[model samples]
Target: MAPTAALLLLLSLASVCFPAAAEETLVFVTVLFRHGDRSPVRAYPTDPYQESSWPQGFGQLSQEGMRQHFELGQFLRSRYGNLLNGSYDRHEISVRSTDYDRTLMSAEANLAGLYPPSGGQVFNPSLKWQPIPVHTVPQSEERLLLFPRNDCPRYTQLVNETEHTEEVLNITAEYWDFIEFVNNKTGLKNTGVDSMWGVYDTLFCESRHNMTPPDWVTPDVQQKLRVLKDFSFQIMFGIYKRVEKSRLQGGMLLGEIVKNLSKMAAPDPQQRLKLKMLSAHDTTIAALQSSLNVYSGKQPPYASCHIFELHRDDNGSASVSMFFRNDSGAAPYPVQLPGCPLRCPLEDFVRLTQPSVSQDRDKECQLPSEGRDKEILLILALSAGALLLLIALLLAVVCWRREPMAARGYQHVLNQEGGGDDS
Candidate 1:
């Protein structure tokens, strides 16, 4: 009822409703989408889910994929209506994808949704929409884009660092047992299958597109593969800590990122890139997220998006908020930087994502067969095989032990009844 109290209350309400217009802040959105419906990426020679089985041949985005992307574009349109123009502005956004057809097409479908050509937006009247460019690099040339790349300097260096420390290697007899068991069952040479997130990401992408696995892949095999995926995620997170130490720990990348961000925030900011959308496999998302020091222990599902919104307070202090959009959860997951509240300081944000620029990504993200050293990684391979076997045995033991005594008793009773009847 007091005038002073009423005035303070009004001011607080005003700030809540019209907080410093965050409009000046450049919204950087990076979206990672699995390719839409498609045939299997690669079928084993004996695979039943070959190209012929699908309406589209192997690795082509399906109509469902198109709709998913289109809807996503609509979502973007709704979210950033003001930030976007009445028409598509090439300068406002840059799109990139892996060179695979499905990926390229997925990008197109996404663009169709994100930047549907309207009246003048169209190239031809007959067509409802026009082509918006989706950029890509040759798969062979894109080392940083590949998975399980054997030549990641950061990864190699980390291994060396950890290996140098006697305690971290932690090789044990149990490990050898695992290696031997795996070598016996798979018939493949001793190989360390540590980097499986990428393979799983690619496979998951294919499955989402309706690609089927070969009959040779039993349910157990699928489950093991999923475990490998989880392990790969763990490895990814471990590798990131190493990377942070090398690239971002000193606040070097963080500094650069902050500088670029400042430029982007400038009155004459780099209008060259309004929105940057990166369409990559789930591993790519995992890798970046891990580096950002936030690993949720799960791979992002199809069309998962991470958005960084920048804002400036009334006094012109920079801040950022990170949002993750995944399929399963009803709401976006918000992550804030350490020293900041719900929103983080921009300097920290830059520092976190800086590892991407620090490493020679071209060499690190490459496929293993090409970039990997040929020095017969036998010892490690054998050890890995042994470790896998140990894991299998441990899992088996756990399952067997969990069976209740009642279950065994019932089985014994059935066996006795069968034997008596036979006699």
Candidate 2:
């Protein structure tokens, strides 16, 4: 009896101590990253490099850009090797890029580092690279892969409101003298807040390549310009009602990401795609970060990446985790969404981001009917009056041309009498 009692006690202890271990499985990942470094998009009209100085002309990627993406690919492989297969698998991953040479090439280079050929996958003996397709759409048709889409009138209206904000005004006033100096130095016509980014970009790219900037660009002046440029970027996506701005711009991408995550969380036996990669510009990264409220107020550096990871546990519950890999040498840092845990539950993630996701972007971008009511009414009134006048003119013309039936009969009789006289 004592032995039996001891056995029962041991069984109870085991049941209490060894409750089923919670199983955590990585389900899906979405990565959005800026293209690697490249030549200036365009130089000022008075600048030295112009269009001819660059090897591949304006906006082409440099060799350093290739290296940067390759290293980034290696980092991804190390971080996700367990989740992703060792070799390139088309069914498991999809990559999309903007229709730009730099971005397209960056995707190709990153793939090289992420998946080097092994065993039967090697097509060429000497080269370690294998072709992995990178897809893109024309710039005009691209909406998903880009941000701050110009077609959104609501976003444009928001931008106008942002410009009129007191903060923007103060920044403009603070830099009035600097703007004048830049205008005078560059001989650029009508230089102001709108055109300052061009000057800063030209100078920045030149400085990065060891080219001497103009003497007028003193350290203090450069710092001020940097501040203004940063401010400009902030206002472009942040400042004054950022959430609404996101609904029309960056939130489109986020919405797609959230939808993909939710779909992955569903139980499916044939779910093969493990990763989706987007190769885009610095603005793309900044816009997404702004939507997430994680932007650091500075432009995203070259090859910066934001990662979205979905994890599912054994209990049939799923959660989302986000990480930012802005620095090449360091590990990706975790970022928490506002009003949610760092590893937020999937349902909570969807709910928190739903407000920013627009159901119909075109509808949201349309101008309000109230604002155009008066103009439309005036146009309609003018059209109706013109139509009435046209009808009156037609009636008058028909009346003037009409001949009386009696006059027609009398003419016929006169003709008959004339014929009898002739006979």
Q: What is the lDDT of residue 393 in candidate 2?
A: 100
On a 0 to 100 scale, what is the lDDT of residue 82 in model 2? 88
State the lDDT at 386 in candidate 1. 100
Q: Give the TM-score of candidate 2.
A: 0.85
Q: How many pairs of residues collide in each model?
A: 9, 0
TM-score of each: 0.64, 0.85
Index of the highest-TM-score prediction? 2
Give per-residue lDDT, candidate 1, residue 231. 53
Q: Which tens-of-lDDT digit does each residue in 178-275 have in candidate 1? A: 43444444443544445333344445555665666545446665565576566545554444354543332212323333455666654445455556
TM-score of 1: 0.64
What are the per-residue Cα lDDT tens digits for candidate 2 across 38-108?
Answer: 88988887687787877888788889899999999988899899889999888899999999999999999
